[model samples]
Target: MKRVTGIGGIFFKSADPKALGAWYRDHLGLDVTDWGGAIFEWGGADSAKGMTIWSPFKQDTTYMAPSTSSFMLNFRVADLDGLLATLRAEGCNVVGEPQTSEQGKFGWVLDPEGNKVELWEPPAGE
Candidate 1:
């Protein structure tokens, strides 16, 4: 049995939720709503389109680390360098250096709430 299809959605809790949402909207040039949340449209030129909804999940459970919160948000991107440059220009705290692996290319950035968002550049010929 082939399991379910690709990732349907990802939801995570956040601190300073409003600030986080606004940051994504401003720096990333995303269509985050005024009320703040992201609804993504997933489709390559040759692939069928699917909708992705994102929001800051409400956290009622205990923190995952000694002082850190639970969960992080990762976004797959095409132009990693461009995006990273833009993020840095906006004065975002870019954590760690960009890297490549068998899966493809990867980079990380931390949000205001200290959530690490991963950016990925898929391998060619996908």
Candidate 2:
């Protein structure tokens, strides 16, 4: 079972999300949108087109909860259910159940260092 195929997104907490986003837009030319983030699209030599999201959340947000880490990593997976079961069998700290949305199917797990990791299986043809 192939686990993580690629990074789906990178999310981190910021003291001032607006200001920080603006800085990234102005200085780094990240094309930060009004929602305070950017989507990067890529196509590998032998891979299908894919996207990776970059976003920052307010410092007080509880999205990365159950872990005190300032950031969470979202990984793209081929099979969310199968990989999650494999992680559980391997004694990994898998968290929560899988969820489906227009964007994709999502799940969460905590690493040994207590960092919350998000797993995503994007909708077909995405």
Candidate 3:
């Protein structure tokens, strides 16, 4: 019943995503990828290995839609379905149906402040 294991990613809106990513890459020494993001890997082979993503989106992007917040927090979850169910039963503001992709499974919810929160369940061995 582990609701959240860790932070999966941090996404925010930027006036110019490409330039912003470059700034971070140049000034902060972040290895921003071509896709305009960076992946920070952690944990040991003997332990549970995981990654946290850092990315920026265009100001008009609708990815973080339904939320006017400048930033969005993505949390890693061990069991997306189970936790989503629990959240719904607890009167939480769970958003649309879950989605799956090569990255993993994703779900959404809105906090009391109306900020959109993303829940992710990574594929096995990731």
Candidate 4:
């Protein structure tokens, strides 16, 4: 049998959740419901949402307060340039420039809480 499908939602405790949510909306332009926790609708199974929650614990670090996860969540995107441009225009701290590796074109964006959020544009045939 096949494994799970994809991530559904990521629920983390933010020090200032309101500000964090606003940051996600202002920078990434995600559809933040509750006025702040932005949700990006990923295309997958209708049942996929029920089957998976992408808030998998970071393997590299042991559990502590939810805030210290030690790694950022990554979202695969279609248009990296446009998104990055918009982020820059919004005065966001887009770090280290965009890097292309075997994985794909990747970059990092810092949230209001200073957590690094990674964005990737997958290569062809992915």
Candidate 5:
């Protein structure tokens, strides 16, 4: 039951997500995409390790709800279902039901300090 393998993404609330992304793109040289996020490939774009995402959302967004934190951390996991079940059994505050998309399985849990933590299991062969 390996838990957090590595950081999957970093999401934060911003007054102006586009502007902030642009700033990072211009100043920090991040390859901010049209959707206002950047992906950093580890090893390479086709690496088995996958990439990490950096995105910002609107300040009023409820994506990080149930927690008053300004940012949420997304962690890469080998087994989302198993890890989530283990977390729940360990008395961790597992959030909503898991979801699936092209990006793979996703789940969340609140940290002791109440920060929203995202768990991501990349699609097979990703």
Candidate 6:
């Protein structure tokens, strides 16, 4: 079974999310939105249509709990449930149950280094 296909997003903590976002917007021209992030559309002859998100959370955010790392990597997966099951069978530290929203289906797991990893199955046709 195919595991991770590509990176879905990159998230990190910041002392001042707004300031950091503005810096990216002004200096890096990231088109940071009011939500303090930007979506990068990508399509190549050898790749599937997709987008990558770049965001920064407040330093105190508890989203990456169980991980002391300051960053989280979101991976794009073709089959979230299947891949998660395989990870569990392989003794990976699968986190909470998977969740689905308009955006897509999401699952969490911890890598060997204890970094929180997010697995995402983008909404159909996305």
lDDT of 1 by residue, 29-87 (tens): 66787767777767789875533334455686432222255665667677889999989
Residues 31-105, model 2: lDDT tens digits = 788788888768888879877777789999998888899888776778888878877886777887889999899
lDDT (10s digit) by residue, model 6, range 23-119: 4454234688878888876778987776667778999999988888988877677789998887788677899889999989999988655777788
Among residues 3 or more apart in sequence or in different chains, the pairs in candidate 3 whose N, CA or C atoms overlap within 3 Å are none
Query: On a 0 to 1 TM-score scale, where does candidate 6 land against the true structure?
Result: 0.65
Quote the lDDT for 94 in model 3: 86
User: What's the C-alpha lDDT at position 58 in model 2?
Assistant: 100
The stretch of ten residues in a row with the least summed lDDT in candidate 1 is: 61-70
Residue 40 of candidate 6: its Cα lDDT? 73
lDDT of 2: 0.77
Badly placed stretches (over 4 Å) of model 5 are 1-47
User: Where's the lowest-lDDT run of ten residues in candidate 5?
Assistant: 20-29
Q: Which pairs clash inside model 4?
A: 32-38
Q: After TM-score superposition, what is the CA distance of residue 32 in candidate 6 from its true location, in Å?
A: 30
Q: Compared with the true structure, what per-residue lDDT tens digits does model 3 show for residues 1-126? A: 888766666666567788767645543346899899998767886869666777789999887868888787776777899878877886777888999999999999876556677889999777
For TM-score, candidate 3 versus 5, the one ahead is: 3
lDDT preference between candidates 1 and 5, better one: 5
The lDDT per prediction is 0.70, 0.77, 0.77, 0.69, 0.77, 0.77
How high is the lDDT of residue 42 in model 4?
Answer: 47
CA deviation > 4 Å runs, candidate 2: 1-42
